[model samples]
Target: MSTPANTITENPPPISTGVTPQRLSTLRRWNIGLTILHLGQAAAMLILANNFAIPVLSAYTAGRPGTIGLTTSNLFDLRIGWAIALFLGLAGLDHFLTASFGRRIYERDLTHGINRFRWLEYSISATIMVIVISMYWGIVTINALIAIAGANVAMILFGWLQEKMNPPGRTITTMLPFWFGALVGLTPWIAMAVNISLLKDENLPASLYIILIVQGVFFFCFGLNQWLQYRQVGPWRNYAFGEKTYLVLSLAAKSLLAWQIFAVSLFS
Candidate 1:
């Protein structure tokens, strides 16, 4: 049979790890939907930032305790909602760009069995969370705050490597990188816990505990998602399943954090 002129018969190349056009379409829709959700949440948080935002304190210590040139550290207070907004919006931007540019933006990520933008978002958002926790526990020294952020960012990057170095068809038999990342990620949380404990739980805000529990649970879920993906457990055998799970996790984590903060700082 002779082909008709200008007939579209050839299939477009898949984006990211040989994802089919159908899968790519599904992913694009998923990105669009999640982007809307993230942006919506971010907008709400931003609006609330003006009056309901939580206090985030930053300090600069002039010298070590009891040392010469020691000066009273000046604390700078910032709004927490703004941080939340940025966190949510960064992820929204990731999804927005992914959906908008489709293949061009997501090709590398999908090809590598990872989302670089996701890790990048986490690097910022998760760092913010850690910083908030640190300040809440009075770990406000500039050096300590920087270390916390650096550790969190490093952990997130290691997570990126966890996927980038072990894509599908590569026979990924171990998840050492993920475990190591988790270990590294534990620093800030553990430090927070120690600080809380040392303070003897005297007059601490109940919201602080709530934040810890909620964040801890979601952090575990994030690790579980990656582990399931690596082990190819059940539905996770499909890369798209893992991807979808990640999207859900991201949304749930951000939403829970935002609402929890809102409940304490705004609605209360």
Candidate 2:
């Protein structure tokens, strides 16, 4: 007797719906544009921080007992603009490589390879985090450490949940490094501001003012663009924080931080 057809079972092969070369080229263009923008902003900030802000503050309180210098020479003895540019350039390259590799794996239907890459990404990021924290140990204050740790923990947990619940796309793999690098790129500025504030000198207020203006503008623009892009491409966009909420919250945070900094500049 012939076996019933219903008793047989079959599983379909995984589909290979990889990203095309044209799409990759487009993404590369976008990434390059972002890199340029980041570099330009960093250059402007360096000019403001080193040339304009420092000289003005120094001149204003030249002989004051509690006044201190705000120049790059005094603060870190490092070129802030070049550092930012280098970090951003590396970040852009990381994003591009990750995206390209992911696309190739998808095209080849290499599930195991994709998982391996994910682990490697996490490992590299964690290593970099350790190195950064160690490098800035004395410079980074307790409050800044707490803030950064908290933000990173939240991001990590959220990413884990995302991977479990919905997995990730090629786009996310690319964007993750860029976002992390952007956050890291802000560290130097943040550290300097904190140092100046803690010094409790006459120039502290002016230093804070410059940081507020520069950071406020940077975060506002970057956060807005990220929010918009997240709306367009985020995996959980439909379920979690919708596009409007994301954009509104990001902008609101930027404004609130700006106001706080302004208040510190005025009253501190």
Candidate 3:
């Protein structure tokens, strides 16, 4: 009788490159999900901010003859909510798009260090930070342009950071972008707290309260998701700084958002 052919097959060698197909797919899915979630948030907030608050402010100004016309203070308060919502929306989209790019980079297994993508990350993070700061400082001239630039920068950075941190079989890099993204995303919310004293209107207070609550929910989910991803990828030696930073900032952001909502509700 002919000898039976061995049924066993040899195992394939490990990939000696940045990231793997499985991990890349997971990251892509995460990025896409984050993008969708943020986009949903942006759309919802836009509706509320524009449809509800703007109209209320308009009516308050037009209907009440003697009421101080939309004061600088009122405008500022309204804009604060608008800016936060807008930032969240843009950041969400940025994360999704950048992660997509990162996936491409990882797939190609580029030889350069993460620095290759640093410009992209820095551009996005810096631009977003600038727009947020400008809005806070009341620099309206290039706010829209800045917002767009920030979004683009953030997406590029997402890709760059992903490539830098998550080289194949590595867990540290995978979580880094999520953590950084959370921190960067939280900056606007933190800045908004400075103006909490300015939102004096009755309706505006209630609306803002709701928005803050929504923000909290958003970040809470984001943090939890990142943690889960970390669990899946196992451990690494990088400074846990990113995770710690994300948690702290996320909690702070949630707290501020909650406090504002509570403060607003008290008046209502």
Candidate 4:
């Protein structure tokens, strides 16, 4: 029996059959890009931190052979470098954990229990960063980071807890709170980036200023991407909040925090 024309017109074929080539390409690109960010950030941290050790240690040993020692001027880096390295290692671990999220999402395995635990892990990382920051500068903005980190803890524990039950279906327990935290965290970086962008030749050499501007652009782009991910655009448009988007956003936000929190310990 032939179907009626009106019925056939109303119920057209499904738009997608399976994962298309374009989607596979996008996934590959995302994986590559995230890996670059992970490794690049780690390398940058090591190089920048080691800047203090190289010349200062050489000078301290008065050009002795195979010398490795610290001096008064570079002591700040000594105090904080290890902590920064430790933090970077944790961040690197996040990259690996997040990489698995894509598969989990596809499997429809993203759960409220897992999300709450994820938030818990983030809270711990943020707390460690705060403690590390204290060893360098007692800046008031560090207090804001503290608040943000603490808020994540609260959101995971109080606001998100279904309490004594394995909740049904997929859910991001801490998505909205994390969005707010990310925005609030952007405050100091935005101000710094804009301020640095306005520096003149006398303030900093042209090349250095240009690098700073580039960093600013990176920060801005991260924020914009974050807004999209938060809204579940493109690859993120799954179950309101999906593992892939949150995973990438977490990496970006954590990288941003590392950039800001250790700015003085690093560059100075």
Clashes (backbone N, CA, C under 3 Å), per candidate, total 2, 0, 7, 0
Q: Predictions ranked by lDDT, top down? A: 1, 4, 3, 2
Per-model TM-score, in order, reads 0.83, 0.36, 0.37, 0.42
Better of 1 and 3 by TM-score: 1
lDDT of each: 0.77, 0.39, 0.45, 0.46
Local accuracy of candidate 2 as per-residue lDDT tens digits, 1-268? 8889789767654321233355445544544454454345435434433321111011223566777852222323323233333333343344445346554543232221122332333333432332232222234333444455455444434333333333324334334543564565455446645655566456333544544455446444544444443445454333222322332333343334333432442223
TM-score of 4: 0.42
What is every candidate's alpha-carbon RMSD to the true fold?
Answer: 6.0, 12.2, 12.6, 13.3
Model 3: lDDT of residue 123: 56
Q: Rank the models by TM-score, top first.
A: 1, 4, 3, 2
lDDT accuracy of residue 146 in candidate 4: 49
Best by lDDT: 1
lDDT of 4 by residue, 134-184 (tens): 222222233433454554345334322322132332244235544454555
Minimal lDDT window, size 10, model 1: 52-61
Compute the lDDT for candidate 1: 0.77
- Any idea how many clashes model 2 has? 0
Cα-lDDT of candidate 3: 0.45
Tens-place lDDT digits, model 3, residues 1-268: 7656986667653343334456456545655665676567656555544321221111224445776654322223334345545545555655565567655663344222233432443354335433533333233333343444555456446545654565435535356676666666555455455445564555443554455456546545645544554454443122122222333443344334423433443223
lDDT value, residue 261 of candidate 4: 39
